[model samples]
Target: MSTLSKIEPTDATEPVAEVLAEVKKALGAVPNMAKTMAHSPALVRGWLALSGALSVGVIPAPVREQLALATAEYNDCEYCLSAHSFIGSKVAKLDPDEIERARHADSADPHAAALLALSDAIARGRGIVEDAALETARAAGVTDAEIAEVVGNLALNILTNYFNILADTDNEFPPVTPLAHA
Candidate 1:
């Protein structure tokens, strides 16, 4: 059971209902995470705005999904892990091996590996990232714009992860392998 009752689209009010409509249109359904967030209409709005901005940012969709997966795994959030895994595979077309590697913040692509390492560092370091980590990302051809996008993506995913943990939101998407810590 969830710690809070999810506000379903049918029961949502005003702004929440409007946002839920858009979410459903974009995602094919209102994910439980979004529904749980609808408990606070402002949060759902803010999340939608941030998510929309990040969708067109410099980072490619696959890398963004990879970062999300890595952040979810690091945070031990089952809801986010499952959600991102589904989107990462079906929408982003990431291979099973890529998704598995992403969970550990490792990737076969050099540039992606560096960004994934930085994503893990940001989560583990609590935003007190070391200079060497930044340098590594730069050396791997991650530009300033890309770095900023990575940070944004990490923040976005972390918000969902923390929310899912607090809400204990029911999984509405296909389940992924459980994290060892979970």
Candidate 2:
């Protein structure tokens, strides 16, 4: 159970109802994160807009999922870890080993590994990654645009992770334990 109650689409009035509809359309079902965010129409709309925008960005789906997984683990947000774990496997077709490795911001691919390490540096350093880390990623072939996309994706995941942690949102996806994956 969440600290905040989940609002069902049917029970939502005007503005919120419309937002929830969009969420359902985008996700195929209304997950708890959206339901909780439905309390504020703007929050839900902003989240959806950013998510939609980033979906087509330069970063591929697999790496984006990796970013989500890495951030979720960093922030210790179980809801996000679980959600991304399921999405990473089902939607992004990440293998179990890949998924697990991503939780540590690691990948066998040098480019992905570099990006994940950069992400962790950004998170750990409070959005201020060292020049060396950026250089490392650049050396790994992560483009400036891809680096920018990483920040964007990190912001998107952090919003949900912080929101879910604060709201204690129920996990609708398969349960993923941070300790086990960590």
Candidate 3:
């Protein structure tokens, strides 16, 4: 059970209601995470702005989804792990094995592997990426613009991961396999 109450569209204030409508239109339904975020209209708006902008950014959708999966796994956020796994497979066309590899921040594609490494480094290093890591990403063909976008995507996923953990947000998407940490 979530500690925070989700703001339903019909019950939302003007600003929140508007944002919920947009979320509904885009996703075909209001995700639990978005609804939980709607508890604060400002948060919902800020989330939507950043997420909407990133959706059209340089990084392709699959890469973005993979990065999210890797971040969620590192952060140990069950809600995001489940949500992104579903989105990655269904919307981003990532296969099961690909999704598993993404959770480990490894990819078969050289370029994608580099980006995932950077994403993992950002999460593990708390955003203080080393010069060598940046060089690896650059050598893998990630441009300065793409690097910036990857950082943005990392931040975005971190926000949701932290939110879900803090709020104990219910999983609305298909369940993903739980991580086994030894």
Ranking by TM-score: 2, 1, 3
How do the predictions measure up, each by TM-score?
A: 0.94, 0.96, 0.94
Candidate 1 matches the true fold with a TM-score of 0.94
- Poorly placed runs, candidate 2 (over 4 Å): 180-182
Best by TM-score: 2
Q: 2 or 3, which is superior by lDDT?
A: 2
Q: What pairs collide in candidate 2? A: none
Model 2, span 1-182: residue lDDT tens: 68999999889999989999999999999998999989999999999999999999998999999999999998989999999999999999999999999998999888899989998999899898789999889999989999898899989999999999999998989888886554
What is candidate 2's TM-score against the reference? 0.96
Of 2 and 3, the candidate ahead on TM-score is 2
Q: Write one digit per residue (lDDT tens) for candidate 1, span 136-182.
A: 98999989998788889888998999999999999988876557864
Give the alpha carbon lDDT tens digit for every residue of 1-182 in model 3: 79998887888888889889988887799999999988777887787789889999998999899999999998888899999999999999999888999999999888889999998888788889899999999999989888899899999999999999999888888777557542
Show where candidate 1 strays beyond 4 Å. Answer: none
Computed on alpha carbons, the lDDT of every model, listed in order, comes to 0.88, 0.92, 0.89
